[model samples]
Target chain A: MMEQPNRGRANIVGNGSVGGGAYTSVRIVGEGEVLGALGCDTFTCTGNCTVFGPVRAGLFKQRGDVTVKGEWSGGHLKTLGQLTIEGSVRAAKLDIVGQLTAREFVETDNLKLQGAIEVNGLVNADQADIRLYGPSRVNEIGGGRIHVRLSRLTAMKEWLKPRHSTELSAALIEGDDIHLEHTRADIVRGNRIHIGAGCVIGRVEYSQSLHVARSAKIGEEVQL
Target chain B: MEQELISKKDLLEQMDISYGQLYRWKRKRLIPEEWFIRKSTFTGQETFFPKPLIIARIGHILQFKDDLSLDELAGTLSPLQTDIRIGAEELRMRGLVSEQMILRHAGLALDSGQLPFDQAFYLYVAEHMSQLLRGEITEQETGALVRLLRGQLPKLEGKLCELVALRTESGSSMVLHTGGGRLYADERTTIAASIHLDEAIEAFKKKLYAY
Candidate 1:
């Protein structure tokens, strides 16, 4: 299934819509849309693109805005601009430099984000390195090695506009090694948890060790 | 009918496992999403799991972590993804079901190219029931059980159901219904033997796909 050979290539040089099917490569140079499910080897989009159905590609790279009405699943996904998915996402590797809004869950093996993310459902990843530049919100986040902090550039921008807060808010966060900064959460549970500066946590539960910054506000702390 | 539940706090403490491992297994889909039951408590919100099922699953994972990868463990542990088809010769060779029993059961011909999942399941359950109720049930009851399962299993796919054998002075009959609740029998009949369908399926898959 991983080897897709001898399939036709779909190319949209201008604004157009292509019916989704198995393809060796799908390249959209300008605005385009996919009508149905697509299974391709590689999908690349330079301008905006919309996929009405699900997509399963080997390597997916998008530079401009992209919206997936259905689920998006692939081996490697790297996006530069804004990305929105109405359904869930399952990718082995996800790298996003801009904003991401997912109405459902997002599961990946490795997630590297430089901007903000809004997920209505849980975000589960094995290794998550999120540098929030804007406000982010998620229902829950769980994984193995989770690191979240406000980017240095965002901190400089927030210093001038102190009223606006660019923090990551989650209802529940559970993992093994967790380091959080400027994160608001209802509950945080992990083995080794470090609550960095500018965090408001309702509760903190740790098994091994816990370090809370003086600037962070915590309602309760329990070591189990 | 309510199932016995263990909270997230107690489960981690009792299992001596970290939250990372639990959530990691969940992400890998080794644990079904429906098992995580959330409810409001005085503290705000709490997550719970069906006590016995979670314990058994975690124990299984711990025992096999050294040998099998998570993907392989998921293939054997996940109940909702049971789509295994075995040939008649392999089934007979594996001795999953007795030869005489397969011969007696309908739609279980030895020469059938491939035995569908449902047929193989029915035969497995019938054989299990006969062994469980050796003295209580007769060959005719086994046939009846197979028929009852064949008609009801499709409708209750991916759900936890039960196969019950009821006997009275008149005769014996079988019934299939969703599990986790008590079944009431009138004054005439008594419940002979009841088998949880999901548990049976899990056990069957473990036997078939185990390395």
Candidate 2:
């Protein structure tokens, strides 16, 4: 079903779709799509949904596949399934499970990612905890505290997808305190940094302390 | 009067700044286009800058580049209009300037209570107080400084210009020129303290433009 611009609240059940418009609260059950900009107070999608334009919401929760083609900003965003954002995302708190892909920067106060993730631009947060499941790639990651570790399901997924590697590849990773495992980067800078096993890095610049696992490969380490 | 010009090569060598940094700053409008004077020499076409102005500008940029982002530094170097307000007590506590002197020189009545100062008034106080702290200045000089600042601050609003300082060969005096006006200070004066103006204005702009 297709509807015009909605102002107050909207609920799309089953395979219903809405056109570009503003809504106070939007709830999409089953498969639904929004063709244009979406401004809402709360957005909840239980199934598959696609937003083609910028989305501004106070609260956004998705339990299934979701895709946003433009910039997105919200107070809180929680996703349980595959979430893909083509543009930047700014949120107060971001908690994701399953799989996530953001083509541009992701700025948040706190971020917790379980499963696989890919970001083409920087990921800046106050605190970030990432558990990598499959091939994950981020151009840059900066925050106050960051921890990245591979999940136990990596081997199972590796067997399922032999073409994709289970390692994380990043150009730069910077933070005040950083710990990484099964990751590869060109440069890593922080006040305290620890590179765990199965990691390869070009350079490590740390201020206070640095620890490199015996299995990690690093080209140079500098204390500043 | 013939302006003294420094070759691009000489300026880069003297300032110890890279060519990339200079071009980047130029692209950002931190340095004026007219400052880049092109002339044919034995080698080929060469660019030049007014020696005194370029030196001062480069020094200022280098000093503050670490504290402020390039965009913020560009804002500082440019004479962008700003509306900065501060309470009298807050100013005093911050030690940005001497409140007593502000009252005496800028003619701000202390008994008028703790009213906030506008941008021009605030900058005037900051400029003079920085000078006053460097050393002793005659009452006449203080009044003249205040008058000069008052006259210049308003005109600088909404314009794009840079503050440039030229130190004398003897290193005993310096001339600060900005927005077509000049102020001379002796060795006892501290020019670095004036960096507060850049910081203050940047903070104000951040607050004003925060969505």
Model 2 chain B, poorest ten-residue lDDT window? B167-176
Model 1, A51-155: lDDT tens per residue? 988889899999999999889888999999999998999999999999989999999989999999999999999899999999999999988889999888998
Candidate number of the best DockQ: 1
| Chain B TM-score of every predicted model | 0.57, 0.43
lDDT of 1 at B154: 71
Compared with the true structure, what per-residue lDDT tens digits does model 2 show for residues A1-224? 12446477788999988877778789999999998989888999999999989988899999999999998887899999999998988888999998889989887778899888899987877788998877899987866788998776774665576444678899878677899988999878777899997889988877779999998999889886
All models: lDDT?
0.84, 0.71
TM-score of each: 0.72, 0.53
Pairs of colliding residues, candidate 2 = none
The local lDDT score (0 to 100) that residue A79 gets in candidate 2 is 94
Give the DockQ-based CAPRI class for model 1. Answer: acceptable
- CA lDDT for candidate 2: 0.71
Residues B1-211, candidate 2: write the lDDT tens digits.
2456898757766897644466456645687656777687653345678775677678888988999987788877555422123345544445445666566664652334443334334444444444634644445545655565556655656543333323344332222244544455667654432323454555643332222
Instruction: Mark the regions of model 2 whose C-alpha exceeds 4 Å error after superposition.
Output: A1-6, A155-164, B1-211
> Which residue pairs in candidate 1 collide?
none
